[model samples]
Structure formats: structure tokens, C-alpha cells
Target: MYKEPIFLKPVFKDRIWGGTKLREEFGYDIPTETTGECWGISAHSHGPSEVINGPLKGKTLDQVWDKHRELFADQEGEDFPLLVKILDAKTDLSVQVHPDDSYAREVEGEAFGKTECWYVINCEPGAELVYGHHANSKLQFEQMVAENRWDELLRKVSIKPGDFVYVPNGTIHAIGAGTMILETQQSSDVTYRVYDYDRRDDAGNPRELHIEKSIEVAMIPHVDADFEPVLSGNEDLRMKKLVRENYFTVYHWNLAGSVSKIENPAYLLVSVLDGEGELKVEGETSSSFKKGDHFILPSTIKNFAMNGNARFIVSHPTI
Candidate 1:
């Protein structure tokens, strides 16, 4: 049976639009000044996380998933289904779209497609994101792209800390500059860039744009889904159900002292965003956790209790 929480070491990624907030705010030993993303609890091929604690120390999450299926409650999938990341956007990201599962399987040869949600960790005042497009039809979308009418076609929304947005596949979107967010998504990296705002790579060439593929996959008229968070808790701990969809379930948990609960899901992914805490598994073991710590509570741990004042973003795959 699982006793100790499996803590994972994050893998960092550098991006042209990245910044140093990951280092300054989260106290991470960032690799570069332009380090943009931290793959905190990921098992994706691009950046698999390494276990830093317990018996599984030094093994990658992907290795554990393949060898110790029971740790994940024997989830039926060839690859891990979920990926969690923290993004620090110093400049605007490329305007892009992603294909759904069917499209991704057929075209990209991937098992999952990205349907991501973002928790706004922090942002500058007047910060905005390119959430959707104004095009009413496929024809209009193509026309706008051809005519270079970005200002008229892109829909910008002002944002702040603590805001959350759900982005399903086929939705054209971009993270604007001066924003930091924690992103939870399916374990796929098939992005179809539609616009890059004339940005060039270090090689002095314009970034590639997938016009045909993007047009084939993008939604004709982007429609935002209404997701109302379910709030429930007691005097000690408060839980905010962020998104419960086909891909995954996410929540924000705030703990004041201590709370006890039975563990029933396949597994639990916990990321401490603020404060410190200690987790104890009944008749097993306990571990001290602090801000910026990320871990997994395996299904074998049937009951657990958390004590101390802390805030977290917790998630688990749906299938």
C-alpha cells in the first residue's frame, strides 16, 4: 500500500515569451532567465517529472506509471492522461489552436488532445488575454486571416489574480504578456499556431504558422462554456471545485488547521501554492510540505489527513 506522498522534481522549459517569476516567486532554481514553464507533475515525453522522495526516489513519473500500475489504481491508458504546468508569460504567446482527441489521434498520432484550464496566479494591472475570435463563420475566419485583420478578429479579456479560464480543444487562444498561471491539461503537445505577431526565433527566421491545419481544426465560432465552481468545506478547510469535465477534475483547497478524508480516486495530484502543511496517512507515514511542493497521493493510501495552514491546486484525471 502507498504510504508516503510521491514528491516530483519539476522540469523547466525556456520560451521566447518567458520570464523569471518562476524563480523569484516560486523559489525555483530556474535554468534560464527566459524559463517560461515548469512541468510540475508531468509524465509527458517532452518533460517527464522525476520522483524526489520515498522508495520511488530518482525514478521518472513515466517509469513508475509503466512499472507500478497499481500506484495509479490501474488506470486503463497507454500513457499518463494529465499534465500540470506553471507558465510565466513575459510576452504574448503565439495565437494557436489544438485539435480534439479524434483529430489528434488521426493526424498527430497522439493518444490525447489538450483541453487545458488556467488558474491566474498573478498578472500586471490591465493585463489581458486573447481568449477567442470575433469571426462568426469559417469563411469570415479565413478572410480575416488572409486580410491581416487581427485587431478586429481577436477578442481580448482583462484578467487578474485568482481568475480561472477553461479552454477546450479547437478554441483559438493566446496567453498575453505579464501573466502567470498554473495550467492543467491533457498530456498532449500538439499545438497549431495560427499567428505569431511577426515574432522570430533566435535563428532570425519567422516562426512557422500552420494555416491549413489550424483552419481545419479551429471552431467556426468560438463559444465559451460556463463553469460555476462548487464550494464546500467546514471551519477547518475550504474546497473550491474548479472544473469537473471529461478530461480531468481540478480544485482549489484552503486549509486552516487539519482535515481528514478517505481517499477513493485513482490518485490525487497536489500542488502547494501557499503556506506550509503536513500530510499523514493512517498507520503509514507523514511528510512535511511547503509552498511550491508538488506530489501525488496514490490510490493505495486509502485514508489521509492534512494539517497546517496552506493553499493548493489539486487535480486528478477522469479516465
Candidate 2:
């Protein structure tokens, strides 16, 4: 069967500050919704169907979850797999951490934890994002929490285009502006916010903090900080690869009016980043293409090709 990219609606969490319909505003002004993914397509049940097109077509993310459930857990029942979203983080988000699988199942029953990464779309001057932190122990993190010195212990880094940040479960981090990103993560929204720039809600109320939980889950000596994308040759096919020992390996393929083929990775998600293109599957199967759309390559698609001047991000877990 043919599959295509689906654009879902983004349910916004209105803050004291937030753009009006980020998908319509920022996505039109800048690039797609590959930024912070707050009001972005949560992609699944908890996410919005912000954008759409292609074979996987009308299938809601929940439907896909039933099929790809094995990837998330072994039991007949399990937490949904990774949630993918395009984030247009117009401002700084909270510094938080997600519990690991063990902690999640134990503490937050019937829930799975989220470990994620941000594939930068566009970043502005003076932008910074959460990388890691200074504390080396959970007890120490708790102490910092007691004194509210979490920011002092965090490892903040300058943000720019073409950057990749992988945040595993238990790592404290946040997405800072100005940034747009493609986020992929375990399908759970159990985030423990440690800090949020003293910003209030529309009613001027401070957002409550999950201080104790954050202190318990924050990882020490966080090793997956300071991430960089791996650039491939340009000219005919310019590809940039971002790999983390996580649930996904995201890469951008910028190509001229030439054909290219990628083999091996069982299934494929082609999100057109620029221009138009056609994908040729193992059989005579082919699909139309456009920017900001997504399509899934048949798990049976042994081979495929690009037949136009285009650019897209191919995402999949690194087995």
C-alpha cells in the first residue's frame, strides 16, 4: 500500500507568551514546525496532526502505534513508541527530565518515559539550549533543588542551525529560542520541570514545578551533551546525519536533479524539507513529494531513489 506524510493539528499550551497558531505563523515565516514541538504536532494521541500528505495518509498516529508497538515494549500492552514532532520553539522552554522505563512503570504506572533529541531547523543569535548539568549525583541535584540552584548546575550551550541534541531519560534539559526543530522521543509526556524563567500563565499564575521528581530523575555526568550533525558530501547529494544511541537517527538529504538510493534500514520516513521529489520503491511503486510532508517507506521496500531536486529528513531508530 502507498503511504504519505500526515500534517496533524497542534494543540497549543497557551503560556503567558506564545505565538498565534505557530504552524501558520512561524512555519510560514521560517521553515516547517521542526522546532520545540510544544504547539507542534504531538504526532500521536497526545500530539496534534499538524501537517499531512503521502501513503501512511489518513492513519492517525495511534493506529500506527498499534503496529509499531513492539519497538517500545514487549508485553501485548505497552507505552506507545516514540512521538515525533516539529517544534517551533519561539521562546525558552522549561528545564526538565523524563523518568526512565523502570522509574516510569514503577512510579507513574501505565506510563512510559520519554528520551528524546532535537534536530535543529533554524536558530537565531544568542540562542541557547539545555545540554547537561554540573551535578554528579542525585543527592547533589536534590541539594541544588532545595536551594534552587539548578540553573547553576546545568550545562547551557549556544544554539544554531544544523545542531543536534540528544536528551535521554533522567537528563535535565530544555529548548531555547530562537529555534525550530524536529523532535523524536519515547511516547510519554511525563516531564518533571525544574525551572521555567519565572513566566506565568495567562492568569499571571506561576506554573507549578515537579521539583522533587526532577531531582529524583536528573542524570549525573550526563554524557550525551554537545551533539553535532555528521555532514555528508554535497554537490549531487548533500546529506547530514545526526545519530544518538536513542530511538532515532535523523538525517537531511539535500540533492540536486539527480537520482540517489538508500538501502537497509527496514522502514523509512521521508519528510520533505525542500523542493519536490519522487521516491521509487523496490517495486514499480513510486510517490509524489513536497516540502513539509511525510511518507513511510514500506518495511518491504528493499531499495529506493530520489528523482528530483529536493531535500528531506529520513528518520529511524539505529538498530
The TM-score of candidate 1 is: 0.98
lDDT scores of the candidates, listed in order: 0.92, 0.64
In model 2, which runs have C-alpha deviations exceeding 4 angstroms? 1-17, 20-43, 48-57, 64-80, 225-234, 244-246
lDDT of 2 by residue, 1-319 (tens): 4332234434444443234334563343322333234433344455534334444446555665566543222224433355666666677788878998888889987366778877777777888988788877777767876787856787898977877677778787888866777777766778788888777775789987888787677777677656577887657778788764656677778878665666736555555656887766654656777666655554555566667887766776554
lDDT of 1 by residue, 1-319 (tens): 6678899999999999998999999999999999999999999999999999888999999999999999898998889899999999999999999999999999999998889999999999999999889999999999999999999999999999999999999999999999999999999989999999999999999999999999999988989977899999887889899999999999999999888874546699998888998888884587999999999999888778889999899999886
RMSD of each: 1.0, 4.4
- Locate the minimum summed-lDDT window of 10 residues in model 2: 70-79
